[model samples]
Target: MPARTPWIRTFLCRSDNIGVLMRDPETGACAAIDVPEAAPVLAALKETGWTLTDILVTHRHADHVEGIPEVKRATGAKVTAPAKAGAAVPEVDVTVSEGDTVSVGALAGEVWETPGHCADHVSYVFAEAGVVFAGDTLFTLGCGRVLEGPPETLWRSLSRFLPLPDETQIYSGHDYVGSNARFALAADPDNARLKARAEEAQRAAAEGRFLIPSSLGEEKATNPFLRAGDPALAQGVGLAPGSEAERVFVALRAWKNRF
Candidate 1:
């Protein structure tokens, strides 16, 4: 038997937060990456007719878990939260840490302790499915704000995705591609790929579409945060070639913070 691809749906919620629903066709088991809000998740389930089986939380942020209780009460779905989140998140039926496997029917995702956006942040990498639900740790062309740990920690967390295949699909927590594209252009103006991606982002926004679920390949080629080791990015950030990637990354993030 071959591995079946899980069906995925992406929608906007809570102004900029992205809502995701992943369903296993073999067993009809469905999981929502983060709630953001209950209405959209419920409506999506109703529209797709996919039963909500689980809610996988990436971090303890209120925007991510605020809809858990209502959604759980309505669907009786199990909730899987990060162990480090502790009491910050509610209605957690299971707490997972690094290397833990979370199963939604026959589909399984390896839990990576990708803490940088927050102390409890975790990313779900369904390698076989070629998908990773990266909460706030990574975005379209940027990374999360360093709120909990140093930029080095966030760089380490982002590095977890570096080893994945180019085609791996990444679903981040928010829709910040427009701003990220602008920032990417400012940070790596010499990269033609970044320029093209920024134009694509502009067109997508004009068409009322989003650039969520971007491939690791695209991110690597265009995202400045992921290209900290590239000499072009180092120079763009006013650093010399061969500068430490971690140092470049910190400078880039600081520039982004002020950008």
Candidate 2:
């Protein structure tokens, strides 16, 4: 029988913005996924009772990295970010690129350069934890807009994530599940999974439960951005049935931005 992997507790700061905390069970060390603001981040640290050991910045967005200095000043944790994002994130102690590994106590993660939302964007894959800090690149049932790069770049970035083990959990930088679900419904109105998910998200929000950390398998089934290659998705967007996957993806994303 395969040995059980240690379970790490994940906390959603839910600060009306984004911040995720991953704590190492053995060492009581915590890795901050993205610090949207300082106050909530500090509060999360206090609530978790875990000392901050590292900060993983997926992009140079102010909302994501603006709190680095304050958090660092308070906890003195090492900051790891993309090499190209150095100018934006001056406090990053370690510059990492695609395939580079970072560890906080017993927790380890690999950095995947995922440039599209921004040229310097990257995603951290914590294999042992079965989670990916996708920043603004990918969201629950949606994805980031092409603010800086070509649609092709965004498509490539999204594609790189598709093949991860199906059960891999995705933790995005924003809480846009309801909005994403609305767009997904417009993009594929007849999709039962999309319809059910949209309803479920509405109910969850009404009850004040955060809908996040969606699985890759679930995204593959429901996210219009990730399912752009499907013939039905192409049809919904008025693309030719035989359209290239990238073209369909680009159209779907363009539509969602306006959605």
* lDDT of candidate model 1 versus the reference: 0.94
Per-residue CA lDDT of candidate 2, range 1-259, in tens?
A: 1122333334444354567888777677778887878778788778767788888888898878888899999999999889988789848889999889988777778889998999999999887678888989999889998889798998999999888888888888888898899889988888998888888899988987756778898899999999988999999889898898999998898887787
RMSD of 1: 1.3
lDDT of 1 by residue, 87-187 (tens): 99999999999999999998999999998788899999998888999999999999999999788999999988998989889999999999999999999
lDDT of each candidate versus the true structure = 0.94, 0.83
lDDT of 2 at 41: 79
Give the TM-scores of the predictions, in the order they appear.
0.98, 0.94
Model 2 misplaced regions, further than 4 Å: 1-16
Which candidate achieves the best lDDT against the true structure?
1
Could you tell me the lDDT of residue 49 within candidate 2?
77
Candidate 1 residue spans exceeding 4 A from truth = none
